[model samples]
Target: MGLFSIKILLVLIIGYFLGSLNTSIIVGSIYGTDIRKHGSGNAGMTNTLRTLGKTAAILVIFGDILKGVLSYIIGNIIITAIPDSSTLYISGIGGMVGGIAAIAGHNWPVYFGFKGGKGILTSFSVVMMMDWKLGLILLAVFVVIVAITRFVSLGSILACAAFPIGAAIKGNGTVFILFSAILSILAIARHNGNIKRLLNGTESKIGEKKRA
Candidate 1:
């Protein structure tokens, strides 16, 4: 039991370290831009896209989301090794879970003075572990909403809301429900600028990208 517990803690520390690698900052630095100094002052995919180009944006998004997924897998594998939920190696499903840590890493990367993106991609990656089916549904919602409204913030916010919507519909336990609520709040916090622009009706559309 003690060994199993030690392993889980090891997973947590390793997962956090893995999550701390901030790709946005590296990409931005490569381009001679702080990225945070650019669009929305955020080190995120949107800012990368707006500042660099499509390729850079895609890479950043993929990398950020991948880190989340990979770290979750790391923790998940450790938990699985214990072969029972009663084991001390099991991790919770709350905000401090594998998914949330990834988001934390993105929003406040230890490698970069705790300055990072809002963790939207990392949040989405969380669903990948919870249930790819739900993730796909939320993803579809994200695409449709983003396509119709052309407002990235609106799409993300709505999709996040879908978490609770799906949970309530499926009669899920409180873990996912509580996670949805907190994820929504984090998403909102990350999009404070977009929120302002949205209030003013000046937020950019997908293709009509603007400089921050």
Candidate 2:
């Protein structure tokens, strides 16, 4: 394989493996149970907070965010280490590609029977790494939505929708805008059940206690 191709492959693999780490599940195991078996049955920070409490949830938040940041950094390192990589916007592209792979792995982790979190936190981290300005825009949108509605799902969905728009507004390249759109789609898709519940007015709001 060409050097560029090899670098891309390595970045993709690293991102996937890092995402597959599944912080919630790992934290759950430490607490003596499978987090997926309780609460929302979703292995993620929100569910972890509901099922395992604050400490576990905090750990998951850090771990998942770290996965995205590390993936981007590592991918960029790989791209920059090779000659002629800068000719194709390879640094940015590689980082975004790794970020995408990380989100994909989080959603359908190979180690977790292809069932996992909805990828919100990881997406936030990746977006931050890609462009802090865009990330801030999404974060503001998310915080406002969640504060007003108390619906984390709504915040996440709306924030995801804002990604591509924010990227475009920032005058990012077409490729980056396209990648942002893909990430947005992937996140919204993962929230399919939440969307249904939202429509039915039965979706759980943030801080709502999990039933026994």
Candidate 3:
């Protein structure tokens, strides 16, 4: 009802729609295939790389990252535009809300039958936009884990779990930390299959070719 509430709602709606673009699926269709039906059945960069190729994967990464970044920007813009704002940190809250909605959309894209990627890249991009330093730290954490185990899923899981903790340690406000935690939970939940495979030592390692 209030202008602030309306702006926040608009940001969420726009962010989710942007995220629902589902870059991998779009690229797969351009190549006459459905990426979700191949490899790990994940419409993500890694699976796109395996099923399509480097170019398609790059496109997916770019598109996914773009949507995340745009969502944050749109959220910030919408909130900051409001006059006589009661909340001093409302812009940050808006950004977080938009970012999380985008991740949700990526994880379960409405445009693609509510099935989509794990939202790893989209979340990473959103966090990076929110706090570059923390984003770099998380990126380092992910790289180290993936480099050590060659398991992208494990890296993603651990990095996601660390986000809220890192935000807390950095003295972020409660809402920011809570939003980060939500992103973490969403990412981990989306990787449920990967977690099971990891426990069983059956999860595909990064760069592992799918058998034809």
Candidate 4:
């Protein structure tokens, strides 16, 4: 295979494996329980916080964010070795590909029965690495929405939806924008259950513990 192809393959493989390392599951295992069996039954940061506690939740969320950031850095480094006139562009695309792979892995982790987090934190980190301006904008929107509505899922959905739009407004390449859109779609899809509860006014707000 060609050198570029080999590099791309390596990026995808590494990103997937890294993403598959679900922090919530790992933290839950340390406490002798499966995070997926508790609270919202979703093995993401919000669920971790609700099922576990602040320490475990913080660790899991940070770990997930690290997965995305590291994936982008590693992919950028791998693609940088290619001798091309468009090295910057190639690296940017490679970084996005790696980030997307990580998000996919987080959503459907092979290590956890194809079940994992909703990928919001990981996507945030990835977008930050991809474009800090866009990332900050989305972050602001998320914070405002969550603070106003106390609905973490709603905030996450809105932020994900804004990614592609922000990318487009910032004149990101078509491929990058398209990939962002795909990531947004995946995030929204993962939150399907939350969407249902939200519509029915049965969704859990941030900081509200699940009832026994």
In the order shown, the candidates' Cα RMSDs to the true structure are 3.0, 1.6, 1.5, 1.9
By lDDT, the better pick of 3 and 4 is: 3
Candidate 3 Cα outliers beyond 4 Å, as residue runs: 87-89, 210-212
TM-score, per-candidate, Cα-based: 0.85, 0.95, 0.96, 0.94
Cα displacement (Å) at residue 187, model 3: 0.6
Question: For candidate 1, lDDT tens digit of each residue in 38-72?
Answer: 76677888778877988888888888888888877
Q: How close is candidate 4 to the true structure, as a TM-score?
A: 0.94
- Candidate 1 has a TM-score of 0.85
Best by lDDT: 3
lDDT by residue (1-212, candidate 2, tens digit) is: 77777888898999998888899999999999899898878888999998788999999999999999999888888887766733555348888989999999998899989888998999999999999988998999999999999999899999999999988988998998998999999999999988988998888888886533
Report the C-alpha lDDT of model 4 over 85-128, residue by residue, as the tens digit. Answer: 54335438778888889999998999999989899899899989
Q: In candidate 4, how many Å is residue 187 off?
A: 1.0
In model 3, state the lDDT of residue 90. 51
The candidate, 2 or 4, that scores higher on lDDT is 2
Least well predicted 10-residue stretch by lDDT in candidate 2: 82-91
Clashing pairs in model 4, backbone N/Cα/C closer than 3 A: none
Q: Compared with the true structure, what per-residue lDDT tens digits does model 3 show for residues 89-152? A: 5548878888888998988899999999999999999999889999999999999999999999
Model 2: how far is 59 from its true place, Å? 0.5
Residue 96 of model 3: what lDDT? 84
